[model samples]
Target: MIHSVLESVMTANGIHSINRLHRLFFKLFAWGIMGFVCAQTAYAVPVDTKSYDPASGVVVKIAGKTLVMGWDTPEGSTELTLNLSGKGALVRSITVAPGNGKPVEVLRDIDPVTILTVGQRDLKKRGGWTIFFDRTSRKPSESGPLTLKLKSAIVRSVGRRCIVELDGLEGQSFSGKLRFTLYAG
Candidate 1:
Protein backbone atom coordinates (compact mmCIF):
# COMPACT_ATOMS: atom_id res chain seq x y z
CA MET A 1 0.00 0.00 0.00
CA ILE A 2 2.79 2.46 0.84
CA HIS A 3 4.48 1.59 -2.46
CA SER A 4 1.30 2.39 -4.37
CA VAL A 5 0.94 5.71 -2.58
CA LEU A 6 4.56 6.58 -3.36
CA GLU A 7 4.04 5.63 -6.99
CA SER A 8 0.94 7.83 -7.17
CA VAL A 9 2.82 10.79 -5.65
CA MET A 10 5.65 10.32 -8.16
CA THR A 11 3.19 10.20 -10.98
CA ALA A 12 1.52 13.40 -9.78
CA ASN A 13 4.97 15.06 -9.75
CA GLY A 14 5.52 13.99 -13.44
CA ILE A 15 8.24 11.46 -12.43
CA HIS A 16 7.98 8.33 -14.68
CA SER A 17 11.42 6.71 -14.87
CA ILE A 18 12.06 3.92 -12.32
CA ASN A 19 15.76 5.00 -12.10
CA ARG A 20 14.82 8.54 -11.04
CA LEU A 21 12.32 7.17 -8.53
CA HIS A 22 14.93 4.81 -7.02
CA ARG A 23 17.48 7.69 -6.79
CA LEU A 24 14.89 9.97 -5.09
CA PHE A 25 13.91 7.19 -2.63
CA PHE A 26 17.52 6.55 -1.67
CA LYS A 27 18.23 10.27 -1.21
CA LEU A 28 15.20 10.66 1.07
CA PHE A 29 16.25 7.57 3.09
CA ALA A 30 19.78 8.93 3.51
CA TRP A 31 18.46 12.34 4.64
CA GLY A 32 16.12 10.66 7.17
CA ILE A 33 18.95 8.59 8.61
CA MET A 34 21.25 11.61 8.83
CA GLY A 35 18.58 13.66 10.61
CA PHE A 36 17.93 10.87 13.14
CA VAL A 37 21.65 10.54 13.93
CA CYS A 38 22.10 14.30 14.36
CA ALA A 39 19.06 14.50 16.63
CA GLN A 40 20.28 11.63 18.82
CA THR A 41 23.71 13.19 19.25
CA ALA A 42 22.30 16.66 19.99
CA TYR A 43 20.07 15.34 22.79
CA ALA A 44 22.43 12.67 24.16
CA VAL A 45 23.07 12.72 27.94
CA PRO A 46 26.35 11.88 29.58
CA VAL A 47 26.44 8.39 31.12
CA ASP A 48 28.44 9.60 34.13
CA THR A 49 30.06 12.79 35.45
CA LYS A 50 33.81 13.37 35.24
CA SER A 51 35.56 12.93 38.59
CA TYR A 52 38.19 15.31 39.97
CA ASP A 53 40.44 15.39 43.02
CA PRO A 54 40.94 18.36 45.33
CA ALA A 55 44.30 20.17 45.53
CA SER A 56 46.52 19.48 48.52
CA GLY A 57 49.34 21.66 49.92
CA VAL A 58 50.47 23.61 52.96
CA VAL A 59 50.42 27.43 53.01
CA VAL A 60 53.16 29.52 54.64
CA LYS A 61 52.94 33.24 55.19
CA ILE A 62 55.20 35.86 56.79
CA ALA A 63 53.36 39.15 57.12
CA GLY A 64 51.69 38.06 53.85
CA LYS A 65 55.00 37.61 51.99
CA THR A 66 57.24 34.70 50.97
CA LEU A 67 60.58 36.45 51.60
CA VAL A 68 60.58 37.30 55.31
CA MET A 69 64.16 37.38 56.55
CA GLY A 70 66.34 40.47 56.11
CA TRP A 71 68.97 42.55 57.89
CA ASP A 72 69.14 46.33 57.99
CA THR A 73 72.42 47.00 59.83
CA PRO A 74 75.85 45.41 59.88
CA GLU A 75 76.10 44.71 63.62
CA GLY A 76 72.78 43.81 65.17
CA SER A 77 71.08 40.48 64.81
CA THR A 78 67.55 40.08 63.43
CA GLU A 79 64.72 37.78 64.46
CA LEU A 80 62.01 36.52 62.16
CA THR A 81 58.57 35.20 63.15
CA LEU A 82 56.50 33.39 60.54
CA ASN A 83 52.82 32.41 60.59
CA LEU A 84 51.99 28.89 59.42
CA SER A 85 48.44 27.73 58.82
CA GLY A 86 47.46 24.40 57.37
CA LYS A 87 44.78 21.75 57.58
CA GLY A 88 46.28 18.61 59.06
CA ALA A 89 49.65 19.81 57.83
CA LEU A 90 53.04 19.84 59.53
CA VAL A 91 56.45 21.29 58.88
CA ARG A 92 58.51 18.61 57.18
CA SER A 93 61.75 20.55 56.98
CA ILE A 94 63.20 24.04 57.02
CA THR A 95 66.21 25.11 54.98
CA VAL A 96 68.28 28.27 54.74
CA ALA A 97 70.21 29.62 51.75
CA PRO A 98 72.88 32.33 51.69
CA GLY A 99 71.55 34.43 48.83
CA ASN A 100 71.99 32.16 45.77
CA GLY A 101 74.53 30.03 47.66
CA LYS A 102 74.31 26.34 48.57
CA PRO A 103 72.13 25.24 51.45
CA VAL A 104 73.93 24.47 54.70
CA GLU A 105 72.93 21.80 57.22
CA VAL A 106 73.78 23.89 60.24
CA LEU A 107 73.46 27.65 60.72
CA ARG A 108 76.75 28.57 62.35
CA ASP A 109 78.61 31.85 62.57
CA ILE A 110 82.13 32.27 61.20
CA ASP A 111 83.47 32.87 64.68
CA PRO A 112 81.76 29.71 66.05
CA VAL A 113 80.27 31.77 68.87
CA THR A 114 76.86 32.60 67.44
CA ILE A 115 74.02 30.06 67.78
CA LEU A 116 70.59 29.54 66.22
CA THR A 117 67.51 28.31 68.03
CA VAL A 118 64.12 27.55 66.45
CA GLY A 119 61.00 27.57 68.62
CA GLN A 120 57.28 27.44 68.14
CA ARG A 121 54.46 29.34 69.83
CA ASP A 122 50.86 28.15 69.95
CA LEU A 123 49.81 31.81 69.64
CA LYS A 124 46.34 31.06 71.03
CA LYS A 125 46.32 27.96 73.24
CA ARG A 126 48.54 25.71 75.28
CA GLY A 127 49.56 22.02 75.13
CA GLY A 128 48.99 21.90 71.35
CA TRP A 129 51.35 21.36 68.43
CA THR A 130 55.02 21.95 69.26
CA ILE A 131 58.13 22.24 67.06
CA PHE A 132 60.99 19.87 67.88
CA PHE A 133 64.43 20.73 66.60
CA ASP A 134 66.20 17.47 67.28
CA ARG A 135 65.45 13.97 68.41
CA THR A 136 64.95 14.74 72.11
CA SER A 137 64.35 18.45 72.63
CA ARG A 138 61.97 21.19 71.64
CA LYS A 139 64.73 23.69 70.80
CA PRO A 140 67.53 22.04 68.85
CA SER A 141 71.06 23.25 69.61
CA GLU A 142 71.85 23.80 65.92
CA SER A 143 69.79 25.24 63.09
CA GLY A 144 69.64 25.73 59.27
CA PRO A 145 68.01 23.25 56.92
CA LEU A 146 66.93 20.88 59.65
CA THR A 147 64.01 18.51 59.58
CA LEU A 148 62.02 19.27 62.71
CA LYS A 149 59.74 16.30 63.06
CA LEU A 150 56.22 17.41 63.83
CA LYS A 151 53.88 15.42 66.04
CA SER A 152 51.41 13.84 63.59
CA ALA A 153 48.35 15.17 65.43
CA ILE A 154 49.77 18.72 65.35
CA VAL A 155 48.11 21.67 63.68
CA ARG A 156 44.56 20.55 64.25
CA SER A 157 42.99 23.64 62.75
CA VAL A 158 44.35 27.17 63.06
CA GLY A 159 47.97 25.92 63.50
CA ARG A 160 50.86 27.86 65.04
CA ARG A 161 53.71 30.21 64.16
CA CYS A 162 57.43 29.42 64.16
CA ILE A 163 59.62 31.67 66.29
CA VAL A 164 63.27 31.90 65.32
CA GLU A 165 65.89 33.60 67.46
CA LEU A 166 69.42 34.56 66.50
CA ASP A 167 71.78 35.11 69.39
CA GLY A 168 75.48 35.92 70.13
CA LEU A 169 75.94 37.92 66.91
CA GLU A 170 77.02 41.19 68.40
CA GLY A 171 79.12 42.55 65.53
CA GLN A 172 78.36 40.60 62.39
CA SER A 173 76.57 41.22 59.10
CA PHE A 174 74.43 38.49 57.50
CA SER A 175 71.86 38.09 54.76
CA GLY A 176 70.04 34.95 53.67
CA LYS A 177 66.70 33.34 52.82
CA LEU A 178 64.85 30.59 54.63
CA ARG A 179 62.81 27.90 52.83
CA PHE A 180 60.40 25.59 54.61
CA THR A 181 58.14 22.83 53.39
CA LEU A 182 54.87 21.59 54.84
CA TYR A 183 53.15 18.25 54.21
CA ALA A 184 49.64 16.95 54.88
CA GLY A 185 49.03 13.23 55.38
Candidate 2:
Protein backbone atom coordinates (compact mmCIF):
# COMPACT_ATOMS: atom_id res chain seq x y z
CA MET A 1 0.00 0.00 0.00
CA ILE A 2 2.86 2.34 0.91
CA HIS A 3 4.56 1.49 -2.37
CA SER A 4 1.36 2.26 -4.29
CA VAL A 5 1.02 5.58 -2.43
CA LEU A 6 4.62 6.48 -3.22
CA GLU A 7 4.08 5.63 -6.88
CA SER A 8 0.97 7.85 -7.06
CA VAL A 9 2.81 10.75 -5.41
CA MET A 10 5.73 10.45 -7.85
CA THR A 11 3.33 10.43 -10.83
CA ALA A 12 1.53 13.55 -9.56
CA ASN A 13 4.85 15.35 -9.03
CA GLY A 14 6.03 14.47 -12.53
CA ILE A 15 2.80 15.77 -14.02
CA HIS A 16 3.09 19.03 -12.06
CA SER A 17 6.68 19.50 -13.17
CA ILE A 18 5.73 18.96 -16.81
CA ASN A 19 2.91 21.49 -16.56
CA ARG A 20 5.23 24.09 -15.04
CA LEU A 21 7.79 23.61 -17.79
CA HIS A 22 5.10 23.96 -20.44
CA ARG A 23 3.88 27.19 -18.85
CA LEU A 24 7.39 28.63 -18.82
CA PHE A 25 7.91 27.89 -22.51
CA PHE A 26 4.57 29.46 -23.36
CA LYS A 27 5.47 32.62 -21.46
CA LEU A 28 8.80 32.94 -23.23
CA PHE A 29 7.18 32.59 -26.65
CA ALA A 30 4.55 35.16 -25.81
CA TRP A 31 7.21 37.63 -24.66
CA GLY A 32 9.24 37.16 -27.84
CA ILE A 33 6.27 37.90 -30.05
CA MET A 34 5.41 40.99 -28.04
CA GLY A 35 8.93 42.26 -28.28
CA PHE A 36 9.01 41.81 -32.03
CA VAL A 37 5.75 43.72 -32.45
CA CYS A 38 6.95 46.59 -30.28
CA ALA A 39 10.19 46.88 -32.21
CA GLN A 40 8.35 47.11 -35.52
CA THR A 41 6.10 49.86 -34.21
CA ALA A 42 9.02 51.86 -32.91
CA TYR A 43 10.87 51.82 -36.24
CA ALA A 44 8.24 53.35 -38.50
CA VAL A 45 9.43 55.44 -41.49
CA PRO A 46 9.39 59.22 -41.21
CA VAL A 47 6.76 61.07 -43.19
CA ASP A 48 9.19 63.83 -44.12
CA THR A 49 12.96 64.22 -44.11
CA LYS A 50 14.74 67.39 -42.96
CA SER A 51 17.42 67.51 -45.68
CA TYR A 52 18.65 65.98 -48.96
CA ASP A 53 21.67 66.35 -51.26
CA PRO A 54 21.30 66.14 -55.03
CA ALA A 55 23.90 64.13 -56.92
CA SER A 56 23.80 66.46 -59.94
CA GLY A 57 22.46 69.85 -61.04
CA VAL A 58 20.41 70.34 -64.21
CA VAL A 59 19.81 73.72 -65.82
CA VAL A 60 16.21 74.19 -67.08
CA LYS A 61 14.86 77.17 -69.01
CA ILE A 62 11.25 77.69 -70.06
CA ALA A 63 11.43 79.55 -73.39
CA GLY A 64 10.62 83.17 -72.40
CA LYS A 65 9.14 82.54 -68.96
CA THR A 66 11.83 81.79 -66.33
CA LEU A 67 14.94 79.75 -65.65
CA VAL A 68 14.70 76.68 -63.40
CA MET A 69 17.34 74.63 -61.62
CA GLY A 70 16.30 71.03 -61.71
CA TRP A 71 17.49 67.56 -60.70
CA ASP A 72 16.38 64.03 -59.78
CA THR A 73 15.91 63.39 -56.07
CA PRO A 74 15.99 60.21 -54.04
CA GLU A 75 12.71 58.63 -53.02
CA GLY A 76 12.75 60.18 -49.53
CA SER A 77 14.48 63.50 -50.32
CA THR A 78 12.73 66.75 -49.31
CA GLU A 79 15.28 69.60 -49.18
CA LEU A 80 17.37 71.38 -51.85
CA THR A 81 19.78 74.32 -52.35
CA LEU A 82 19.50 77.19 -54.86
CA ASN A 83 22.80 78.45 -56.41
CA LEU A 84 22.43 82.14 -57.36
CA SER A 85 24.84 84.77 -58.70
CA GLY A 86 26.10 86.85 -55.78
CA LYS A 87 27.09 89.70 -58.12
CA GLY A 88 23.67 91.36 -57.95
CA ALA A 89 22.63 91.24 -54.29
CA LEU A 90 21.97 88.79 -51.50
CA VAL A 91 18.71 86.94 -52.05
CA ARG A 92 15.94 87.99 -49.70
CA SER A 93 13.27 85.47 -50.66
CA ILE A 94 12.97 82.02 -52.27
CA THR A 95 10.00 80.20 -53.88
CA VAL A 96 9.30 76.51 -54.53
CA ALA A 97 5.99 75.48 -56.11
CA PRO A 98 5.50 71.93 -57.36
CA GLY A 99 2.28 72.92 -59.17
CA ASN A 100 0.46 75.69 -57.32
CA GLY A 101 0.07 78.98 -59.19
CA LYS A 102 1.41 81.18 -56.40
CA PRO A 103 5.06 81.37 -55.21
CA VAL A 104 6.42 80.58 -51.73
CA GLU A 105 9.37 81.80 -49.68
CA VAL A 106 11.77 79.08 -48.55
CA LEU A 107 14.05 81.23 -46.39
CA ARG A 108 12.96 83.50 -43.53
CA ASP A 109 15.94 84.58 -41.43
CA ILE A 110 17.66 87.65 -42.95
CA ASP A 111 21.11 86.69 -41.62
CA PRO A 112 21.83 83.73 -43.96
CA VAL A 113 20.36 85.62 -46.91
CA THR A 114 23.34 87.97 -46.83
CA ILE A 115 25.90 85.18 -47.12
CA LEU A 116 25.25 84.15 -50.77
CA THR A 117 27.90 85.49 -53.24
CA VAL A 118 28.64 85.45 -56.98
CA GLY A 119 30.70 82.98 -59.06
CA GLN A 120 30.77 79.18 -59.08
CA ARG A 121 33.78 79.14 -56.77
CA ASP A 122 31.90 80.22 -53.64
CA LEU A 123 28.73 78.29 -54.58
CA LYS A 124 30.54 74.94 -54.77
CA LYS A 125 30.77 74.78 -51.02
CA ARG A 126 27.69 73.59 -49.05
CA GLY A 127 28.07 76.39 -46.47
CA GLY A 128 26.74 78.97 -48.96
CA TRP A 129 23.43 77.10 -49.24
CA THR A 130 20.38 77.87 -47.12
CA ILE A 131 17.11 76.26 -46.21
CA PHE A 132 14.27 77.88 -48.13
CA PHE A 133 11.30 75.64 -47.37
CA ASP A 134 10.49 72.30 -45.75
CA ARG A 135 7.70 69.88 -44.87
CA THR A 136 6.72 72.07 -41.92
CA SER A 137 5.51 74.76 -44.33
CA ARG A 138 4.33 72.43 -47.05
CA LYS A 139 0.69 73.63 -47.13
CA PRO A 140 0.51 77.37 -46.41
CA SER A 141 -3.15 78.11 -47.15
CA GLU A 142 -4.48 74.96 -45.57
CA SER A 143 -2.86 75.82 -42.24
CA GLY A 144 -4.96 79.05 -42.10
CA PRO A 145 -1.79 81.11 -41.65
CA LEU A 146 -0.11 83.57 -44.01
CA THR A 147 2.77 81.44 -45.35
CA LEU A 148 4.83 81.57 -48.52
CA LYS A 149 4.02 79.21 -51.38
CA LEU A 150 6.53 76.43 -52.17
CA LYS A 151 6.66 75.92 -55.94
CA SER A 152 8.69 73.30 -57.81
CA ALA A 153 8.35 71.38 -61.08
CA ILE A 154 9.37 67.95 -62.33
CA VAL A 155 10.06 67.84 -66.08
CA ARG A 156 10.88 64.56 -67.81
CA SER A 157 14.24 63.14 -66.68
CA VAL A 158 15.26 66.52 -65.28
CA GLY A 159 13.03 65.93 -62.22
CA ARG A 160 11.60 68.92 -60.34
CA ARG A 161 12.37 72.62 -60.77
CA CYS A 162 13.19 74.84 -57.76
CA ILE A 163 12.76 78.60 -58.26
CA VAL A 164 14.43 81.17 -56.00
CA GLU A 165 12.92 84.62 -55.39
CA LEU A 166 15.23 87.52 -54.71
CA ASP A 167 14.83 90.78 -52.78
CA GLY A 168 17.73 93.20 -53.08
CA LEU A 169 18.61 96.18 -50.94
CA GLU A 170 17.74 99.63 -52.26
CA GLY A 171 21.32 100.80 -52.89
CA GLN A 172 22.83 97.40 -53.54
CA SER A 173 23.94 96.78 -57.13
CA PHE A 174 24.80 93.35 -58.53
CA SER A 175 26.08 92.37 -61.99
CA GLY A 176 23.44 89.63 -62.38
CA LYS A 177 21.60 86.95 -60.44
CA LEU A 178 23.59 83.76 -60.10
CA ARG A 179 21.21 81.35 -58.38
CA PHE A 180 22.05 77.82 -57.29
CA THR A 181 19.33 75.29 -56.43
CA LEU A 182 20.47 72.54 -54.06
CA TYR A 183 18.32 69.75 -52.67
CA ALA A 184 18.37 66.03 -51.95
CA GLY A 185 18.35 64.52 -55.42
Candidate 3:
Protein backbone atom coordinates (compact mmCIF):
# COMPACT_ATOMS: atom_id res chain seq x y z
CA MET A 1 0.00 0.00 0.00
CA ILE A 2 2.83 2.41 0.82
CA HIS A 3 4.62 1.49 -2.41
CA SER A 4 1.45 2.10 -4.40
CA VAL A 5 0.93 5.47 -2.75
CA LEU A 6 4.53 6.46 -3.51
CA GLU A 7 4.14 5.33 -7.13
CA SER A 8 0.93 7.34 -7.53
CA VAL A 9 2.58 10.44 -6.07
CA MET A 10 5.61 10.08 -8.32
CA THR A 11 3.45 9.51 -11.36
CA ALA A 12 1.38 12.59 -10.57
CA ASN A 13 4.59 14.66 -10.54
CA GLY A 14 5.28 13.69 -14.23
CA ILE A 15 8.15 11.39 -13.15
CA HIS A 16 8.24 8.23 -15.27
CA SER A 17 10.87 6.25 -13.25
CA ILE A 18 9.24 5.01 -10.01
CA ASN A 19 12.17 2.91 -8.78
CA ARG A 20 14.77 5.75 -8.99
CA LEU A 21 12.42 8.33 -7.45
CA HIS A 22 11.48 5.95 -4.64
CA ARG A 23 15.10 5.40 -3.68
CA LEU A 24 15.88 9.11 -3.82
CA PHE A 25 12.85 9.94 -1.67
CA PHE A 26 13.80 7.31 0.89
CA LYS A 27 17.38 8.57 1.11
CA LEU A 28 16.16 12.12 1.56
CA PHE A 29 13.78 11.07 4.30
CA ALA A 30 16.47 9.19 6.21
CA TRP A 31 18.89 12.10 5.94
CA GLY A 32 16.25 14.50 7.24
CA ILE A 33 15.58 12.37 10.29
CA MET A 34 19.30 12.00 11.04
CA GLY A 35 19.86 15.74 10.74
CA PHE A 36 17.03 16.51 13.12
CA VAL A 37 18.24 14.08 15.77
CA CYS A 38 21.83 15.32 15.56
CA ALA A 39 20.81 18.95 15.86
CA GLN A 40 18.63 18.25 18.89
CA THR A 41 21.48 16.66 20.83
CA ALA A 42 24.56 18.46 19.51
CA TYR A 43 24.98 20.82 22.49
CA ALA A 44 24.15 18.15 25.10
CA VAL A 45 26.77 15.65 23.94
CA PRO A 46 29.95 15.51 26.03
CA VAL A 47 32.71 12.92 25.50
CA ASP A 48 32.53 10.47 28.43
CA THR A 49 33.83 7.10 29.64
CA LYS A 50 32.70 5.04 32.66
CA SER A 51 34.42 1.64 32.29
CA TYR A 52 35.81 1.25 35.82
CA ASP A 53 35.28 -1.07 38.76
CA PRO A 54 31.84 -0.57 40.30
CA ALA A 55 32.89 -1.45 43.84
CA SER A 56 34.97 1.67 44.42
CA GLY A 57 33.43 4.91 45.65
CA VAL A 58 34.74 8.44 46.22
CA VAL A 59 33.42 10.70 48.98
CA VAL A 60 33.89 14.44 48.34
CA LYS A 61 33.30 16.98 51.09
CA ILE A 62 34.04 20.66 51.31
CA ALA A 63 33.10 22.80 54.30
CA GLY A 64 29.78 21.33 55.51
CA LYS A 65 28.67 20.12 52.10
CA THR A 66 29.27 16.57 50.98
CA LEU A 67 28.87 14.84 47.62
CA VAL A 68 29.59 11.22 46.82
CA MET A 69 31.40 10.54 43.55
CA GLY A 70 31.68 7.35 41.48
CA TRP A 71 33.44 4.01 41.81
CA ASP A 72 37.23 3.59 42.07
CA THR A 73 38.69 0.66 43.94
CA PRO A 74 42.23 1.95 44.54
CA GLU A 75 42.98 -0.35 47.46
CA GLY A 76 46.28 -2.28 47.15
CA SER A 77 46.71 -0.39 43.89
CA THR A 78 48.78 2.80 43.77
CA GLU A 79 46.31 5.52 44.73
CA LEU A 80 47.54 9.06 44.04
CA THR A 81 45.47 11.98 45.28
CA LEU A 82 46.30 15.58 44.37
CA ASN A 83 45.10 18.41 46.63
CA LEU A 84 44.44 20.91 43.84
CA SER A 85 43.48 24.56 44.47
CA GLY A 86 42.86 27.20 41.86
CA LYS A 87 40.36 29.42 40.07
CA GLY A 88 37.72 28.27 37.59
CA ALA A 89 34.12 27.12 37.47
CA LEU A 90 33.07 24.75 40.26
CA VAL A 91 32.12 21.61 38.37
CA ARG A 92 31.61 17.89 39.01
CA SER A 93 33.70 16.81 36.05
CA ILE A 94 36.83 14.68 36.52
CA THR A 95 38.93 14.07 33.41
CA VAL A 96 42.43 12.72 32.85
CA ALA A 97 44.41 12.93 29.64
CA PRO A 98 46.93 10.14 30.24
CA GLY A 99 49.23 11.99 27.80
CA ASN A 100 50.96 10.27 24.85
CA GLY A 101 48.02 10.87 22.47
CA LYS A 102 45.62 9.03 24.74
CA PRO A 103 41.87 9.48 24.42
CA VAL A 104 40.73 11.76 27.28
CA GLU A 105 38.39 10.07 29.81
CA VAL A 106 35.53 11.85 31.59
CA LEU A 107 34.94 10.55 35.11
CA ARG A 108 32.31 13.13 36.05
CA ASP A 109 29.96 11.69 38.67
CA ILE A 110 29.90 8.77 41.08
CA ASP A 111 28.68 6.68 38.16
CA PRO A 112 31.51 7.40 35.61
CA VAL A 113 32.64 10.23 33.33
CA THR A 114 36.56 10.07 33.12
CA ILE A 115 37.30 13.42 31.44
CA LEU A 116 36.64 16.87 33.00
CA THR A 117 36.78 20.20 31.18
CA VAL A 118 36.34 23.86 32.12
CA GLY A 119 32.90 25.34 31.62
CA GLN A 120 30.83 28.38 32.58
CA ARG A 121 29.58 27.37 36.03
CA ASP A 122 28.14 29.36 38.93
CA LEU A 123 30.71 29.01 41.69
CA LYS A 124 29.48 30.08 45.13
CA LYS A 125 32.66 29.79 47.21
CA ARG A 126 36.43 29.68 46.68
CA GLY A 127 38.27 26.39 47.22
CA GLY A 128 40.31 23.70 45.50
CA TRP A 129 40.02 20.23 43.95
CA THR A 130 41.18 16.99 45.53
CA ILE A 131 41.61 14.58 42.63
CA PHE A 132 42.42 10.88 42.77
CA PHE A 133 44.28 8.64 40.35
CA ASP A 134 45.08 4.95 40.15
CA ARG A 135 48.77 4.67 39.44
CA THR A 136 49.47 1.96 36.92
CA SER A 137 53.14 1.99 37.83
CA ARG A 138 55.16 2.21 41.06
CA LYS A 139 57.83 4.74 40.15
CA PRO A 140 57.20 8.36 39.23
CA SER A 141 60.13 8.50 36.76
CA GLU A 142 58.73 5.63 34.74
CA SER A 143 56.55 6.39 31.67
CA GLY A 144 53.40 4.91 33.19
CA PRO A 145 51.04 6.05 35.95
CA LEU A 146 52.98 7.33 38.98
CA THR A 147 52.17 7.04 42.67
CA LEU A 148 52.19 10.36 44.49
CA LYS A 149 50.66 11.87 47.65
CA LEU A 150 50.95 15.52 46.81
CA LYS A 151 49.05 18.26 48.65
CA SER A 152 48.72 22.10 48.65
CA ALA A 153 48.45 22.09 44.87
CA ILE A 154 46.99 24.77 42.63
CA VAL A 155 45.49 24.77 39.14
CA ARG A 156 46.42 27.50 36.67
CA SER A 157 44.74 28.13 33.35
CA VAL A 158 47.68 28.11 30.97
CA GLY A 159 45.79 28.52 27.71
CA ARG A 160 42.80 26.73 26.19
CA ARG A 161 42.35 24.54 29.34
CA CYS A 162 43.10 24.55 33.06
CA ILE A 163 45.83 22.25 34.45
CA VAL A 164 47.13 21.37 37.87
CA GLU A 165 50.92 21.10 38.16
CA LEU A 166 51.78 17.80 39.87
CA ASP A 167 54.97 17.08 41.82
CA GLY A 168 55.62 13.74 43.43
CA LEU A 169 58.14 12.40 45.97
CA GLU A 170 60.71 11.87 43.20
CA GLY A 171 60.58 15.60 42.32
CA GLN A 172 59.14 14.77 38.90
CA SER A 173 56.32 17.16 38.01
CA PHE A 174 53.59 16.77 35.40
CA SER A 175 50.53 18.77 34.36
CA GLY A 176 46.98 17.55 33.71
CA LYS A 177 43.56 19.12 33.28
CA LEU A 178 41.67 18.75 36.64
CA ARG A 179 38.21 20.26 36.91
CA PHE A 180 35.94 19.42 39.86
CA THR A 181 33.79 20.95 42.60
CA LEU A 182 35.49 23.65 44.73
CA TYR A 183 33.29 23.86 47.84
CA ALA A 184 35.13 25.70 50.60
CA GLY A 185 32.95 28.18 52.40
Which candidate number would show the highest TM-score if scored against the true structure?
A: 3
Local accuracy of candidate 3 as per-residue lDDT tens digits, 1-185:
87887778787865656776779889999999999987664322121223222222332222211122322222211112222222222233554433233324453323212322222322332332322232324323333333333333333332223233333222124444334422211
**Tens digit of per-residue lDDT, candidate 1, span 54-128:** 122222223421113322222322322222221122222234445555543343211122234554444334334
lDDT of each: 0.35, 0.38, 0.36
lDDT for model 2 comes to 0.38
Q: In model 2, which range of ten residues has the least summed lDDT? A: 44-53
The best-first sequence of candidates by lDDT reads 2, 3, 1
The candidate maximizing lDDT is 2
Backbone clash tally (model 3): 15
Compared with the true structure, what per-residue lDDT tens digits does model 2 show for residues 1-185?
Answer: 64565467568786676566667779999999999987664441121111222323443433222223443334322223332222222233444544533445576323233232222233334564643322233333221112212233223222343334333322123322223445424
TM-score of each: 0.20, 0.22, 0.24
Model 1 worst lDDT window (10 residues)? 44-53
Global lDDT for candidate 3?
0.36
The TM-score obtained by model 3 is 0.24
Model 1, residue 153: distance off in Å is 38
Question: In model 2, which regions exceed 4 Å deviation?
Answer: 1-13, 46-54, 57-185
Q: Arrange candidates by TM-score, descending.
A: 3, 2, 1
